[model samples]
Target: MNKLKNKVMLRGALSMLLLAGLGFHSFAQKKNWQNLDLQKDSVFGIDTEKAYEELLKGKKSAPVLVGVLDGGVDINHEDLKRVIWVNKKEKAGNGKDDDKNGYIDDVNGWNFLGSAKGSVSHEALELTRILRRDKAKFENVTAAIVKPADSAAFNQYLKAKIDFEKQTDEAKNAVANIGGLKTVLDSMVKKMGKEKPELADFQNFKAESSIEDRLKRIMVSQLQNSTFEAFYSSQIVKGLEHYQDQLDYNLNPDFDPRPELVGDNYADSQQRNYGSNDVKGPDASHGTHVSGIIAADRTNTIGIQGVADNVMIMGVRAVPDGDERDKDVANSIRYAVANGAKVLNMSFGKGYSWDKKAVDEAVKYAVSKDVLLVQAAGNDNKNLDVEKSFPDRRYEDGGVASSYIVVGASGPNDDKTLKADFSNYGKTTVDVFAPGVQIYSTVPDNKYEAYNGTSMASPVVAGLAALIRSYYPKLTAVQVKEIILKSVVKVNHNVDIEMEEGIAPKSVPFADLCITGGIVNAYEALKLAATYK
Candidate 1:
């Protein structure tokens, strides 16, 4: 972890030096560049508005159902309510499965993480669970005691234990440090007799001693050109809450928040019909944001317009706050395909997968049903061809799924800083890139916020797939995937990009980062889809 941090810092420094050399203030401005016009503004957006204005004008298309597999979705959000997919077969608020589809009253799609009582907000990491589950069996056992056939499982257990300990300790220390900083800030605010102290207050503060001077300097630097309230609200408060959540729920192996709420046997993959119909579980922010990016109201003049116009978003709540289980992911894919979803957007992934075969089977099922699966290529900034990320395109028998597409995140900047610093990339594993940084989308309660991750990139492609499927209704899922991969706008230049944050920037051919070697373009894809046989 320290090596990774150092690499990130070095990359950041190099990026700063490069920016200074180029006389650019920053690599990219802090605006919604993902929605900008490509040709007119020179921004690397998907040209959604342009496509609608020129290419897709007066074109009649059918509605495409896009399944959003993530941490729930706000079905009733003002920008998303009318665009949500409703189960016409199952009646709403009924106490029975009206459609006889094994799920009861799935009005706005099913919530695999919900229960009759409530839902969970956090969960232990996959490695933490693996460590806890195998502790008693492998506590004092060595290689001599293990059979040759079981050696691989034992090695995996050892690795999981090491990662669990290291990650938990780091999370605890971060929480403590942030909590202490908040205390100091609170004291300073109280002494100033102001809830929101300006930078001038910190500058004018008199330090009677060395300790006071040190504290004053820290506060001044942190709150420079900003109000104390604003700094606390945006940085300290949110940082504290995030680290605390990691310590209390994500890294704690002894904690299990699912037993009481989601009374399903988690170890049993066959027990699928245990969750409730509450698709909007405890946290709907991630799924809502992705859904809004795909199918938010375009003509309402309320929030931002989505990429695809004639689309229905099906909320499949399978991902939790922490790592999602493979069983739920498999079930979510199966459920989406069974319920007539044409495109499925999976915005969540983890490093470890316990049931890869089940997920592979589900992928096969979706492929057979002609459902396109779009996946995020993680945010680790590592090469996905080397490091493993779950729900990948590879099957158990060394065959790749043709219907699946893995997307990396692309930033707003052109040339050198085109790829997002945190996005994972690989020439073989990553299919293409899309705008994922500072993407403004609908959150819960009809609100909007900008979030960054490859999670945001995957849905952009899924929405494009929906657009293609809606307009060219005869194209299969594999055909749509091929069209997207083949019709990318090739960036024919070398660029300096940080494969990992904190590492020094490396100059590589921009085409080597992804298979397509170009960013996904909506207009180009639409044009190509029109000519497809």
Candidate 2:
């Protein structure tokens, strides 16, 4: 591990120097994005020139299967049809479990969400569960109040208490702040004689405004300026409401909504008889986008081609619109492993994971079966070692299962700010970075949209993993992970970027974000994987 880390660091340093020689910025300069196709020709994405060279060599592997444990995938998508994984054990539509694998007719994959078509907020379920089961323990208690004796329950209650307090504080601050901003904006809009004033209105106001008015106008102007929609329906407002739910009524640790969905407890992984063949769950967009990125058909002149030529996407609707449940994730991993999936791509995460042990066990099961799992580090842009995120192979005891790799999001430029503003990263938590910003891929309903997140980054690595496993079947899961880590090109320079705090922006060395301080290059990764044997 030490040797691999050192080689990656040294190679990264050299790559940075080489890029610098070619005028890649210490902080990459902004490029005009108008009419730009990042997938076809971009400095941050696949080096098309190099990729084409590899294509000529005919070195790509046979079709490989990657289990996508997110929302349901659009299996019928034109670009994705050839690559969607089919469960041969169970017939497609006989209304029976043909393979008798406990799940009833899981021809594609199982949906953990009770209804075959609905959205579940990660915050809503997890927070609601925690608040209900544990709030009583912390009721009106002083700091010195001793927790009751059951070690596991007591510990869980204590954690819930702390999380609840923090969330409550955050919700209060946000509601107050947003409320104040809304007041000022409301007055300004009334003054301008329009509810949704455009830029021209602001300019007109600025021309006639007095000095005091100008100061107020400047403050409002700064608040209104952002690529996102206005403050009312913004991400921050949503985040605040989410926190409020967690604080007030959603933190009960024992709350289980799976009963509402399937009338069975999800914690019982062995109870898999529930759920149906309706693979495209409530929101198919996430799964469809991911599948398109991994194995969408190429040269057909339809939607974009995925990273790999021959790949099969197995849709497992375990993740919902919000955070995923640990039980569902654990079962999904086992199901994929048992179903012959060599690689699993997890693009969802949560701040709370009550049954982490269950997830750890499932990860071990996959590793034992020689399966490699690629997970999204998250999108909070935090140093995760200081915080907690879910779907990790590492146990809380500080040990990691061999087959898991966590990915962070990198941008199209070679600068520090080039890291996606929303990417969650940590030197200890994340394995590598990949092109994640404005990634165009397949969405539900046979559509294509450019979505950005660590979600996109994970699928790219998963594709690379599938390719490596397909060609180099002799390599162990651990060895495959090491090859990917060792082959990355690192950058070490101070670049402007956002931080988790949402305070004033600051600059930091790009290398500090993840264990592999480089982006995943498929061409380089395949070369390294071949050499590993």
Compare the candidates by lDDT and give the number of the best one.
1
CA deviation > 4 Å runs, candidate 1: 1-32, 187-193, 198-231, 496-503
lDDT of each: 0.80, 0.67
lDDT of 2 by residue, 320-383 (tens): 5445667778888888888989899998887767688888888888999999999888776678
Off by over 4 Å in 2: 1-42, 46-49, 115-127, 138-156, 165-257, 266-270, 396-398, 497-504
lDDT of 1: 0.80
Model 1 agreement with the true structure over 169-250: per-residue lDDT tens digits: 7667666665665666577767888878877887887766554466566557656444566456655666666667767877
Q: What is the number of residue pairs that collide in model 2? A: 16
Model 1 TM-score is 0.90
**Model 1, residue 524: C-alpha shift (Å):** 0.5
Q: Which residue pairs in candidate 1 have backbone atoms (N, alpha carbon, C) closer than 3 angstroms, thus clashing? A: 7-502, 7-503, 8-501, 8-502, 8-503, 9-502, 11-502, 11-503
